[model samples]
Target: MNIHKFFANDEIATRPLHHVMRAGIFLSLIIIIFISMSGRPLAQTIEYDLKSVSVLKINLPVSQAVTIVLSDAVSKIVAANAEIADAQPITDKSIYLVGRSFGTTTVNLYSESGAPVGLLAVEVGVNSADISRSIRAALPRSDVKVNTVNGRVQLSGSVNDAYSMEKVLEIVAQYGSPSIVNVITLKGGQ
Candidate 1:
């Protein structure tokens, strides 16, 4: 019962202390090795073609039903097209629905000059949540950005010109809720 007796007995305790210290060191080394191995990066190439992208969202609400339907429809359409190889799920619930099914189909729509030529938006009605989710999902590879402020979804990004801006607007218009007040596009200032 005496705590001091264990440490005071040199012959009985010295060997155990040594063993415990060794085990502690061994465990520490194993942990270090495991962490280092997991942290090491695999050989990979970072894409230099990436452009700056941003998205601004307005304080709005989107319905879930519309988002689900739109994503499903778009995914099917893009899948049947030969030009679109695949669609990846995006962060935006609305767009993510399509992206999840279609697999990055938007990237395929870019023109040779790095301009967006076409957009596929759902004509169906959705709520604010679905719309916001879909837009957020789709913004990762997008050079511009999407965001919401004071019940409005704001689009800010670089495009070829006014026509391209219109095209972008048309694409997003499909997934909007019935009560969506506006679609605002801020030109990349040419």
Candidate 2:
């Protein structure tokens, strides 16, 4: 029997394959268009609320660097004052901020899509290493521990007498007043 004659006798077998092929092509083209459109920008400009800008306060030690992990991928970072601090992108979602001087500056992070992420209020100050050494040398008989937290010098431990405590406070004040939290206790007092 002839193939065409045999197929023509069966309505199911004679169904046009071109119709199925065309339907498949149409479906594939629709999927491709949807995917391409999803990636394209809907508008030319992205608006941001300037009045509701978020601010992050960060304290870093002079000559030291700290890493800040962001909620979104960062494309660029700009420092308000380069002389006070330097910000460099380590990855798409993090940045390394280095303190250059004893001052405060702002760092603005930009998203990969060119939108402002937020502002970082970075304060650069002296580390506690030098201050700790000086305090230890001045009060060799007393036990004193010095640390820095949130741009403040924290002094904790014990002193021999009130004079020693006052001396420690005085030395810390020389560096920066109102930036010292003295938790030092007298030997005989609570």
Candidate 3:
């Protein structure tokens, strides 16, 4: 097999070389398209309302939070309903908006001059992170873990008694979990 025959020298072998080149190019194009389609960016949107315009319309799960960074420095932050969500300002331009309950709330932002900046319309939904956190908070000594599998909240790990196990499940239900997987085991060991 003469490698030179496949190059510019031999005109007869050019036909085969052309087909190979086409195949390689076709494969490369397919790979590029697949890569582009597979990896997509998760976008978050800001609500632009006249009455109470929002900086972010977040569909956050309960027990979880997303950080908000404002272009203008925020002086004061207020959540419409603390039962649904809470806002904690980390800096002048950033705050951590945490989902507290299964409901909707808006966090109003203010500037240094006491002017309204924007609002964050937050909808707290069910998720494993929130459920896990809730369980841990309620029972700090319990070794329970939580995760979402196939849109269901799965609870794992060991507990000292059935009361602790039941308490963990109750917290998951309060978060409006679609389904609960109670794999929690009651053991004598801590």
**Most accurate candidate by lDDT:** 2
- State TM-scores per candidate: 0.24, 0.47, 0.42
Model 2 lDDT tens row, 1-190:
2222124455536335666568789999999999999997532222223346488777677777877766666688999998889988877777778888776889997776888778888877766777788888898998999876655678899999999998998888777634777888899794
Q: How many backbone clashes does candidate 3 have?
A: 0
Model 3 quality (TM-score): 0.42
- Please give, for residues 1-190, the per-residue lDDT of candidate 3 as tens digits: 3232454555545355567778789999999999998786443323243344446667777677777666667789999999889888878877777777766778888877989878777776676666677888999999888765534567889888878877887887786766677787889643
**For model 1, how does the per-residue alpha-carbon lDDT over 148-173 read when each residue is reduced to its tens digit?**
44324555655545665555565567
Least accurate 10 contiguous residues by lDDT in model 1: 64-73
Candidate 2 least-lDDT 10 residues = 42-51
* Residue-level lDDT for 5 in candidate 1: 20
In model 3, pairs of residues that clash are none
- Candidate 1 is scored at a TM of 0.24
> What is candidate 3's local distance difference test score?
0.73
Reference-based TM-score, model 2: 0.47
Compared with the true structure, all predictions reach lDDT values of: 0.38, 0.75, 0.73
